[model samples]
Target: MFATAARNFVEEVDHGGWLIPVSSLNDTVNLLSVVVKRKRFWIWQRPKYLPTDFHLNDILTGDTPIQPVSIETDFIKYDGTYGENMKGSVNANVFDHSSFNVEGKDSSKLQSSFGSLKKEELDVQKLLRDSKNRLLDMSHGLVQQTMEKHRQVFGIVKERIVTTQPCSVIEEVQQGGNCGGRLSFCGGKSPKVSLKENGSLRKDSDVTMEIPIHTTIAYALIELEIKHDGRFELCLLSDTKGGFEVDGPASNQLLGASRAPMSPSESSHLKEELEQLGEHFQVLSALPATTRASLLQHITKVMENKEAVSSLQQVLEQMCQGKRPVLEEVTATESHKKSIQAVLDLLEQCGQTESAQANQSTAVLAALHLITSAIDEMTHECYAVFWMCCSFTGLQTLKKLVHCVSENGELPLSSSGLATPTEDVYEKTEHLFASCQVSLKRDGDTVKTEIHQQPGHRPLVLCIAIKGLASLDQSD
Candidate 1:
């Protein structure tokens, strides 16, 4: 019985040992401060179970585990008053710190590698900054050069002078017809009369005393004579009691002194008118040799009037009448004639008003100036003188001139309808002349230009001359 009991007890003990509770055993082990060492095969197979700081050599050597040492750094403060306290304090514990645990040679290599990377980065930044600065400077210089070139180009354009050729040749015949037609003529016949000794008239001698008829026929004849003679001389007066007569001594004196020197005012006025005329019409300078002589005579007679207004009106009238037909023929448009007529009507209106303002006179002059310019343009003449003259008057005057020219469709233009100088046409013909000569002479404010067309195979040799004067002084 004892043997059987002992056997049961042994069997139960063996079973209890195999069936021990895992939770109770784990708790007992934890409470007893026991070290549960994992098997070497298990540690090698399960890398996750190995300590983070464990090395293969430590495991191979089976060395005792090293305890981590906590390093503390001591910082000492030094006051300026104590020389000995000024010395810096370094902790020996810093050498054993984990951050400083790298091998001495490897630490130096790492520091050098990091320093090289930083230096390269700084050099790259400096190079990039320098390149950017250089690019900016180059751009600034280019911009300045471009601006200077544009300024020079603009200045050259502003100073450039544009010239154009005449639109058409205005024949002297046209000028003469137009000028002569403006004058009135009378159809009165001079009756033959004989004076009786007894102051009694016989039937054959019967005649009535009548006032001499005012006739433009004589004026036309005189103009024709002057044109032919190339010298201004008074027309022979008829001895008949009633005959065509001219203005007395004053008119005769002006005609007689036609070739004589002119006063400064007269010369200046004539120069200005000639310049204005010449600038517009190349033909004005190309007129027959006698034309200038005739013009000088006519101008002298017109200037005999003391009133500047009347004299100016007379000059305008002569130009309008003389150039109207030629302009109309050239343009094939009546706008030119209408424009001149409008100006004439305005001038007449101004004349009627005793209190006409200076501006009214200026306006009339502007219109006349514009009409003359249009006429010159239609004739293929330079019109810049008109613009120059009108510019001094007023902007409104220039606008008026443009308006009139535009209305007439006579504004100088190229075949493409672009505004161009008239000189373009003349330039083409310049090669046709053998010895075309252009000469300019300046005296004080007056400039005289002469163009001589040398005798060639052509039927006619042309010589044109013009005199221009500066604007009258405002003080004058």
Candidate 2:
């Protein structure tokens, strides 16, 4: 009974220690079968569990026979009856008659010298340092060459026209002059040589004409291409008082008084606009990946327009009535929400201001304000929605769902595999039609999931279901 208990304990420990994958267990068994070859043998005398007097004396004499070590001895007895010649093998270290050292010992002096050697004693450090320096030099040269090549490939931009305002213009007309009063003495001297004008010319009336002239301003426009780094080589395109008329205020003279220093308020507004544009560019450049994206979308619907608000109210009204809002129906209606249509119409109206006839400065400013307001409103609404979604589903669950979706793609529905490739979505969508309807409702911080059975009214209603007669409530 003691031996049986010991064996059971040993088996339990061994079983706990050895772990194998289920698929590979059969492979391990097959290998063991070939190695051991099924056989039966009688049990030999059991070895002493503790060291005995013989073991102590054997250590003193160092000439006692050692017990053989076998893999089979670990758990079960092995009989070599199937083999013709059966010889027991013992671990070489088990015997004490032979020399213990596998290889001869090294000289003490050599070992001591090896231990004393410093980093300077080896050439490896120097070789590594030299190699690194060479690598750095090569890298520097390559970078320089690359920069030079780029400089040569892309030519400088030159300006073709120069505009300037001229100072002034003069217009004159000529007519024959009539001899008037000369000095008294000159009149006497000229009396002998003076010629009289013809009668036709004497009686002719004087003709005069006025001509229009233009004056050029003092400002001159100098156009040049510049680098993004703010380091620029000025290439003279043209010098003029007035810059390109096509560029509006932006193309005015750089040195002239056209671009006067802006007021502090103007500067602040411009900076804010630039910063907002940069932020928008960054957001758009990055991929949209967030667990709250759906919630954000819902919030956007709530905050978008008065129409969206009305729609949400209608949903709430219907839900109050005897109606179960079918998630599918809600999702379909969300796709066609009049609030979304309002946003689309707003965008269309904004686009109309871009027509050639609508190129006034006021129109441009209005368009800009409209776009900025829309974006700001949308972002705030979306964020509100995200929090609402978080309130409905605990933050932790939402985070886990996000990570799972990111790593595992879609959730594993009853029949779905670990991951369904998007390419196969159209084919597999039919199989995934059983999602929880409760997960798709739109309510403030809560989604009502209690099943409702009502036969007369519409089959499903949103949170606030408003039916035929009740729709009149909207008019009120």
Q: Which stretches of candidate 1 lie over 4 Å from their true place?
A: 1-257, 260-337, 345-356, 362-476
The Cα local distance difference test for each model comes to 0.23, 0.23
Candidate 1's C-alpha lDDT? 0.23
> How much is 270 displaced in model 2, in angstroms?
12
Question: Which portions of model 2 miss their true places by more than 4 Å?
Answer: 1-337, 342-476
For model 1, what is the alpha-carbon lDDT of residue 358?
A: 52
Highest TM-score model number: 1
Error of 2 at 160 (Å): 32
Write the residue-wise lDDT of candidate 2 on 5-62 in tens digits: 2222233223222211111101211110111111111011011111111211121112
Single out the weakest 10-residue window by summed lDDT for candidate 2: 106-115
Model 1: per-residue lDDT, tens digit, 1-476?
A: 11112122222323212111111101211101111111211111100111112221121112333222222222111111100000111222222221111111000000000000000011323322332311112123322342232111000000000012111111110100000011222335855442222111111111121111110000001110111111212222221111111244533222211121221122233334334444333322232334323433332222221121222333464444443323333221132244434444544555466665454544444344432222221110122222223223332322322222223322232232333323433232222221223233323332233333331111011111111111111111
Per-candidate TM vs. native?
Answer: 0.18, 0.13
